[model samples]
Target: MDRRRVIIDTDTAGDDTQALVLAALSDRIEVEGLTIVAGNVEFDHEVENAKYTLGLAGKADEVPVHEGIRSPLQKEYETAEYVHGEGGLGGELFPDTGIESADAHAVDYIVETARENPGEVTLVCIGPLTNVAMACKREPDLDELLDEVWVMGGNVNCLGNVTPAAEYNFWVDPDAANVVLRELSTTIVDWGVTVRDSTFGPDTLGRIEDAAEDSEFAAFYDTITQQVRAFNREEMGEDATTQPDSLVVACLIEPDLIEESGEYHVDVDEREGMTRGYTLVDETGVLDEPANARVVESIDAEGFRRLFLDAVIHGDPERSLA
Candidate 1:
């Protein structure tokens, strides 16, 4: 198999942990590194959560973790402890591995990796786009160097998890989101609507829980995502777990699993108001803007479920390494 090389910039909490499980165990991709940023929690906890997560899957040594910018580029640093729970692991604590994040800063790691790998590296931003934007600032040609930039953000489809007009990730750093969408040509973005479209119902949940009995990683995932499961049921009225970040990773591993809404010129509102962090997509040709990113309006839910479950519960370790 022609394995894809990838880097994930993440907030490292809640559903992001479930998403990390998919990356850690995937048989068709090599997760080169994970850069931790502040969003769902603070810098310290997010980094610890990331390390705990990697260690939980026994991939702690294989995939190095990097520390990224804590605050947004321009906005004040905000946290989501209420949503992700303290410590970003749904208030659960896995015994500390005594491991520390890598010495390199996340922005520099991103820049150096993309410069070294060229088009072979896929950078998936599952949190705010701060690290990627900072990398591009340091290397203006970064957009041309990487393979693809898959982002699990935006809210162009009557959706908003954090605000009336913004997705949580984008709302965290709209400035960075704008920078990446405007500069990177190889981008595939997922909107908040993707979460609603990609959830696995009660039966799959039961299967995953049952599989947890045999796999430590699966059981850990089941325990950590409990808050998310309850939140979704209460807020969205569904007994399902929505892993949009995992959907982005699955699509990166296999683009055919999702249908494209077309290449779009997207703009994010970076002000503070009712429309803050809103993503404005150019659907019609009237905008006359060059398409910098492809939008995923819908996906093959079954295909995503299969890819996620297979990776998390039945994947081969050999394929997950470099």
Candidate 2:
């Protein structure tokens, strides 16, 4: 099978790092490059996290990292350091991999790459949609150039992560999210999926801890996930930590993992109030609008954990984590 061509756009915090590791190590996807955006933490730190993540898969020199928008398109930048910690990797420090970002601006790189590979590239956006919206505005035909865009943001029918009415990525830059969702053929793997399906609790955590003893990658995963696990348990009242980004990536790598999905007219609310950045998914067809995106509502949680462990521990997805 032809490996899916992908470009990961990330904010590069704890779970974001896990997502990158999944994309980089899996033989099922060809990571064209990584575009860093402003969200999870400081912009520079996010860029560094991307480099460090690539280094884990021994793809440091092969995959190019490009720095994108430093702030939201129309709002001041916001971060999730409270959840991710100061270093963006649970404050863990490591020796430099000597990996540097490409000199190209992320917007330019995104536009050029799509133009060069029309109908072939897929952008897996796991952060705020600033770079993507800007690129679409720059090249109006961008929607037609790329094959697909997979986004890890928003919420379908439930509560959100960042706010009671909105998810973090869409909340950070509602303007950008609106632009991209309106203009692109997109698939949304929302916060609902993370909360409802792919959460890793104590049992799975113990499995990873056991795998860490024999796999350096699993050790890295175990180390970085500590902070988020605590926050999830204490703040969200959930004993499990959610990896939204990695779950979205897994759906792309293995489509069978998606247990349920639907096509809907999905848009983010940009108005100020209690509902700012709230994803207005027309799940009931109240809008009578044509569906513009596919919304993934659920996935096989067990399969996701298996896929994640297989890749992180064995560096391949063919092996069974169970």
Off by over 4 Å in 2: 320-322
lDDT by residue (1-322, candidate 1, tens digit) is 8888889999988878777877777667788999998788878888888888888777899989999998999998568776677787777866777887799999999999988888889888899888888888999999789987788888875678787788888898899988888778745555654665676789988887999988776687678777777777788887777777878877766777776567877888999888888988888857897877778877777777776777666753333223
Q: Rate the local accuracy (lDDT) of all candidates.
A: 0.80, 0.88
What TM-score does prediction 2 earn? 0.97
Give all TM-scores, in the order shown. Answer: 0.93, 0.97
Clashing pairs in 1: none
lDDT of 2 by residue, 1-322 (tens): 7999999998888899888888887777899999999999988889888898888888988999999999998877468877888878877766666776799999999999999999999999999999999999999999899999999999887898878999999999999998998899999999998888878888888888899988988898888887787788799787677889999888888899998999999888998778988999998999999999999987998888889888877878646632
lDDT of 1 at 50: 85
Candidate 1: misplaced stretches above 4 Å? 316-322
